[model samples]
Target: MRGILAGWDSLDPALRWLMRINLIALTTATLLLASAYLLGFRHTSVEIDLGVMAVSIVLMLVTPPLCRRYGAPAAIVGLTLSALIFAVGGTWATPNLSPLTALLTMVPLLVGFAYLGRRWIQVLSVVAVAGSAGVAALAEWRRTEAVSEEWWINAVVIAASLPAGVAVVVLLVRSAYARLQGQSDELVESRRRVVEVADAARRSLERDLHDGAQQRLLASSVTIERARKELRAGRHDSAAALLDQLAADNREIVTELRELARGIYPPLLTERGLVAALQSTARRSAVPVTLDVADVERTDPQVEAAAYFCILEALTNAAKHSGAAEVHVTLRGRPHLSFTVCDDGRGFDRGAVDAGGLLGMEARVAAAGGRLTLDTGPGRGTVVRGEFAP
Candidate 1:
């Protein structure tokens, strides 16, 4: 079964549909033939109907290979034309065949419209319409008292209803395919933005290491070496002073290193939770900040990290760039973990910050399956809002 399915998948999609329809037609024809033989309708040109069914099956059986050679449009046209011929021949052969059987013509019409070119669709559709009409007219002309006066009415209903139903199905398929494509595009864009943000964060980390920790460590090493030389020269007084200076320099280097590490991933976020981490960030902000934090509640670690970083970045942007006197930070724990940071500062255009500091914040939020929105304009206060899934 798996092998068969793999083989089927190898065929063009249009050819697959054509093949499936043909198989179903063959099955139905077999059933009808058996029923006719058993019901004493053997005198109604049953051999002719059997021959038509065999020919349809043969056409269907060869369609996949033909589609591969001639393309899907030609294959669909073949199947459609075969279906029309089957309906016409069967109607002529079996007086018991219902005029409503003409409705089957719509199946191929729909297939042509959905998968074939407009020119082919137009041609096939015309043929289907003409064939259905011909079947109804022939039935009406040959009718006697044995046939109901409303046989032609059934034919009209079949002709009208099948096309409408097929049209609806075609419309629905197109709509679903379009929606899938739109989502695929969005996912691609989101992935690209995430990569850009990640690269920016790496550059920022590298810059911090070079300018802060590396420079400070170099200075501290120089001081320590100078103090060692003084001690070796037996200059106790100068050596003591140099030692104290070295201690201070080393302490400064340690402090700078701590700050750099915190910037990467703060320890406060893990040890004290998002509220304490955010409060620590607020306290360090150059601008004054007010916090409306909810009670500490355990949540997904990734979500907590995203919210904390979002608020932190907003506060940093507000203090350094917004020229704001004060900032407000709000955290909510219910429904979904969320936070908002607003600053009363000179705001900048959101679109203008494409690869700016806010991108790191946006990336963090996106990684957590959250949304980050920035509302800002020149001279207007900026609002940074982030929400996460529960």
Candidate 2:
């Protein structure tokens, strides 16, 4: 059963809906036909109705395989043509079933045009439904069948056009509801990821302060107390040497704090612009870098910051992971702020990318209303690019 319906989930909602309708109708017809002898229905011939049912089941069953092998366009064309044949053929096969088939056939007609958007196919599908309804109405005008057997056929055939329109409305509501649901789910997940990344960064900053600047400040306080004790005992040389060491320690602490702060957000980014900040980053990279940044005017601070950080992360990744000798960095100003970092490194498999590095960059870019993409493969080098909105 799973194999039979393997590709069904990939079909468009409208296509799936048409398939469900056909399945239900086929099941109902099967049951009705089973008891037709008792009801004295299908007494004219079982063979014709049986053949029609068999052909329809076969056509419907083949749709999923075609969807997998040829994709939606081919599958849609085949399914729509089958529906057209079913519509016109049912009217000729049995005037009784024509109204139901004509009404249902409009399902594909409306859905097909909305999805496929081909004018010629639209005209052909429209003609099929209208033509089937016309054929049924003409048969009603000069009918020789028993009046009891044909009580409601013509009324339904006349009303087929209205029901077709209603089906379009029904599908429109369903499509809209589904779209909203999908977007809502994505929004929730995106927010959750942003919060998670922010929490992780906060923890990292706390750890850095505790290990680097905070630890150095505590040690310096101890040294200052020792120097005071030496001065109180009138040991001038000892106190002076201790004071010099304390000054050195203080300088180291200041440098450590500034470096840590730079990791969070660069001071140069605000002072000069994105181009100057990026050049500083390129100079600091472990691998050789060829920087080519456009001297374009700055836009949104947030947009510039996102592009800056993504390039920084990409350069870090290339240095740490890809053993590349040289990296090329590019920034564009026109249309919108964008940047690319390409390295002639021995790239790793994309499937094995570090989620923390790449995902964090992606989230940061998304937060700033931009996009990030990576192009890489083993032994093929790596390229990371980001583009911001105009």
Candidate 3:
């Protein structure tokens, strides 16, 4: 059942139409053969009736491919014409069987028309039921004396079968519509996530270029100018001090650039996985920090990385701006992996600091399919929490 559903879901709209048409044709042919047997074809010669059944089966089998190539409606019209020919022949030759055979013939038309929509389906269903009633009434009128057993039996079968067929076709149409809706929703969510990730990557690159490389170049130019002025004034000691300061500045630039690069894209994330990466970040932080990681083995890589960065950014902000004495980092990897960074510091209003570090952190977390929450106020400690799916 799953495999059949999967195959139906994967089919293109055009192919699905063809499949529906073919199934209708096959079912119609089966109904014709059953009607022939029920009407006692033994009264006629075996050779002649066998030839007629063979022709009907051949016509039904050949119609689907031609209909698929030309047009569905055109093909359906052709099938209806062929069934009408059979209906006329059965009514004249085997009079008692005509109503049941004609009613069965309407099944393909009703099922095929349902693909158009509810309005068309209703129109087709009404037409089919009315036409079947008209044919049964005509047959009843021909035998004016009394209702025969075969006529009553055929009438009961036609009444039960028509409604059951209609109900099954209605359910199939609803199922197809629901499946299409689900696929559309999935496509929308996938596109949204892709855009978020792309935007985050672009912003990270811009920030790194501005804060890391650009700052270093500006600092280098300043140091060179200072050294030149000191040398022109014949102050050897001052020039030497300026040169030493330039060398220290160069080292700082190199260190900061490496850190920025790693933050943008970390090799350890791909290698050691998320737990070790978070541990490494905690070890390198400036403040005295306590780290806790639980259920590390089950967490997804993307979720782990997002949680790690959220904590790293929170710790950096706490150390630099909050005047924090101690910071605690906690991570739990379960149904979802969650990270929390708490600090004992003079906390600032989260609303006031919306654009810079906090906003950037929020964007990063969101891009990773996660959320970041901040808890901070005047004179109180700050807590940063992030959660992501595994």
Candidate 4:
């Protein structure tokens, strides 16, 4: 049943819906035919009615294929009318037992015609009910049957059923459409948030470069210029001391620049991949970290990057804020990629720190079509986990 439902979901919308409607009609017809047989309605007309129902089941099975070969609208309309003919004919043949049974054919018609405008739906429904009644009335007269008052009851039942079915279809379709619209709106908002966060990150990078490394480099240039001036003025000792100070300043700037660059994107991540990069990060953490990374095939670069940052942030948080004695980092590769960072520490309330590193990690994971979960308690350990698809 699960496999069948999966296969049905994989079908094109038009074909799927057509087949569904056909299936429903087929089941209803079969049950009605069985009921007539059990009631001992063994006349030739009843046999003919059963034959019509059997043909309807075949027509229902064939309609989906027809919808694929011919256009959906033409195939659906033709199939609907064909099924209606069988239903009306069968009702006419076995009026004593099949009046309400004929009305079941309209179930598929209501579903199939839902995409057509309301005006067309109303017109077609009236036509179908009228045609069925006329056929049943003609069949009654030809058999020299009396004009039973029950004809009024059958007409009223069918009339009410048709409009009610249309109303239900309209309501279901509209509700589905509204749900889809809401999902679309949410996706748009998520995308906008990602873009905003990315732009903010870019600006932060620029600001850091200007304030930290760029300014230091400019000062180093001035110091070099002073050293050259002292050397030209024949102050050898002064020039030598100035050059020594310049060397120290240069070293300091290089270290600061490296730190800044690592904050943006670790060089090891690009050079050696996620495992080596994460191992380097664990080694650098203030708290001891044990890493368990599965040796498997590499994932997509984007997925690897997102996972790397998520673990990196979690480790940094655990080391800095959690005051943990030790951290455990686990990375799984293959099938689906996932990682977890856990620390046994004085955990803080999740609501209190939901914005900073946690929010960024959540955004990154969401961008990769993944999810991030954080578990923490006041005194218990904190666990940060993320799962992703490559």
Candidate 5:
């Protein structure tokens, strides 16, 4: 069943066309059977019945595709009418068990109607019931022989079984379709959130590069130029002091650039793996951070990177905003990797923080198919937790 569904999903436009062709062929073949029965074998009114059956089959096959493409309700009406025509035509000629075949034809129609949704399903049901009743009455009127007790019981059995079978199939198909739609909706929502986070992260990086690193580099360049001019003017003491200050400023700028680059993408995550990198991050945090990592070897690189960044961002946020004295970082690397960063701070409202660093952290996590959650409120220290599957 899984393979069949997968194959159906893999089909291109041409294959869909082939499916429509096959539906037409099946309808034509059913009509041919009815014609052969009435004309070739039973020797009933041949030309009119054949023409009617052909028209009904053509309507059945042609109308569905049109309705499927254009007007769905009209297509459903076409299918229902096609079934009724077959039922009434069979009843008029055979009058023995023709209504049974007509009811049986409604099974696929019901399934299609259910798949389409409630409005169509209701329309199809009303048509099927009314059509079947009309066919049964026509069959009763057209009977040449007297109706027997056994025939009534058989008719009742056929009538009951056909609709029941159709109902079951329709309900089952409807349930399965609903489940698929729900899963599709969930996937769409997840992707939308991921896109939002990534866009915010890009904007934040642009701001950081423009406002922080760019300005620092500019200041360092100005200091070096001033030092050079002082040295050329034969002011050795002032030049030496200026040069020393320039060197110090350049070093600070370099450090800030490195830190900014790391924030963009950490090299430690790729080199040393998640555990060592997270440990280093925890150790470097401003507040006292307790680090705990278990079964580090099992962690995948992408998972490791996401976990590391989430911790770094959370710790950075804690230091900058939380006014926290202490923080804790923990990692569990079994079943699925999980990380938590908790700080003891004068916590602000999580809702009030605009999506900047936190949003970047979320993007990184989501890119690896993970989730980041922040828990903080007034007087409540923040706890940022993230989880990723392998």
Candidate 6:
């Protein structure tokens, strides 16, 4: 059973539905037919009816592989053609009108409409409605005394067709709406995180300036006063040395400010795009880093920032926390921006994976409208993979 379902997770929505609907419809239809036979529903060709169903079931079984190989549209057309054949064949095999068989005709059209494009949906809707009316008209012309009791088959089919189409549209619209709502919530969450992180960044910047560059500047001012007095008193050599020291201090302050600015947002990430920026990071990393980056077209700065920071954070973990030697970083573009950071680090147990750094990484990815996943096990190493359409 496990082997049977091994590739099920990767199946597309249409293919998965094809499998599920086939199983469920086969089961339920079989039971309904057996019940109808026991209840003495007249059948002119029971063997032929069963033969059609048998052939359809065989075709249905082949659809999954075809769906996997050829994709959704062709598989859907195959499944629908099979259904259309069975419906016509089965109804003709019955003496009066197989009301059940007539109803089953709409299943293919509606399911196809759900999976196919808007044009296909429009085509299937017309086909279903016209087919319903035609089936009813056939029953009307063939209304003999034995079949007189099912004279309402036309009304039933017409009524069922309209409602079924409407129901499918309603369901599809609702699903699309729910997805939009989920996206809206994500945006709100992202906004909240940006606000909080921005506020924290401001405070951190203030503290760094006061503790680092500000004190150096104040000391330099006093040195300038002493240098002026020495020069005024004809101690030119000492004054010149003091001026030289002050010049070095000014250069150091400029370097410190640049580093602080880089911490907020790297200049390379904006100027050269993600791949170049990542290469820069790799060169600077203490751990031996190997990069497998494809040529990337520049994307949104925010998106590039997220990818940069995530990989940067991952590298930080590698250097400071993880007892690791080497790290591999991969990046791809075109279809969308994606990257992976893998480290030969001592991974933690899955149960104890609730570290703040990990949580921050996840939140950062989410804020950028992307998905991120972490794969790790103790002694197995850690992989942080992320993807987003920018």
**What TM-score, over all chains together, does every model reach?**
0.53, 0.52, 0.42, 0.52, 0.51, 0.57
How many pairs of residues collide in each model? 0, 0, 0, 0, 0, 0
Put down candidate 4 lDDT per residue, 163-247, tens digits, no spaces.
Answer: 4334434554665576469658757866777877787788878998999888988988998899999999999999999889988
Question: What tens digits encode model 5's per-residue C-alpha lDDT throughout 196-290?
Answer: 77787788889988898788778878878887898889888998998888778778878888888877777877887877777777777788889
Which model scores highest in TM-score?
6
List residue ranges in candidate 1 displaced over 4 A.
Answer: 1-183, 351-354
Backbone clash total for model 6 is: 0
Ranking by lDDT: 2, 1, 6, 4, 5, 3
Question: Candidate 6: where is the Cα deviation over 4 Å?
Answer: 1-188, 347-360, 376-381
Clashing pairs in 1: none
Screening candidate 2 with a backbone cut-off below 3 angstroms (N, C-alpha, C), the clashing residue pairs are none
Cand. 5 Cα-lDDT: 0.63
| Cα lDDT, all candidates | 0.67, 0.69, 0.61, 0.66, 0.63, 0.67
Q: Kindly list the per-residue Cα lDDT of model 2 for residues 1-390, writing each as its tens digit.
A: 567766655455545665555555554554555455345443333435445555666676777776654445555555555565555545554565555556556555555553454674667576666766675774465255523355443333223323443454465457757756975886786798788888878998899999988899999999999999999999999999999999999999988888787889999999888888988888888999998866468778898788888888888888998999999998877535678899999988867755766777888898886668888889989999887644
RMSD vs true structure, all candidates: 17.7, 13.3, 16.8, 11.8, 16.6, 7.7
lDDT of 4 at 153: 37
Residue runs of model 4 more than 4 Å from their true location after superposition: 1-186
* Residue range 57-151, candidate 6, lDDT tens digits: 66665655544334455555666665665656555544244454455556557556444768877777776677666665654454452322453
- Model 6, residue pairs in steric clash: none
lDDT of 1 at 384: 88
Lowest lDDT block of 10, candidate 5: 4-13
> Compared to the true structure, candidate 4 yields what TM-score?
0.52
Q: Could you tell me the C-alpha RMSD of candidate 4 in Å?
A: 11.8
* Location of the lowest summed lDDT over 10 successive residues in candidate 3: 3-12
Error of 2 at 128 (Å): 34
lDDT per residue (tens digit) for residues 1-390 in model 1: 333323333343444644564566455655656565565544334556567667766666565555433455545666776676667655665433534346656667755554566777788778778877887765555455322345543343233223433443455456547646965875787788778877888998899889987887888788778888988999889989988987887888788888888878999899978888887887887999999976448777898888887787778778778899999988877534678888899888766765466766776787786778888899999998887643
User: Residue 207 in candidate 1 has what lDDT?
Assistant: 90
**Candidate whose lDDT is highest:** 2
Give the CA lDDT, 0 to 100, for residue 27 in model 1.
55
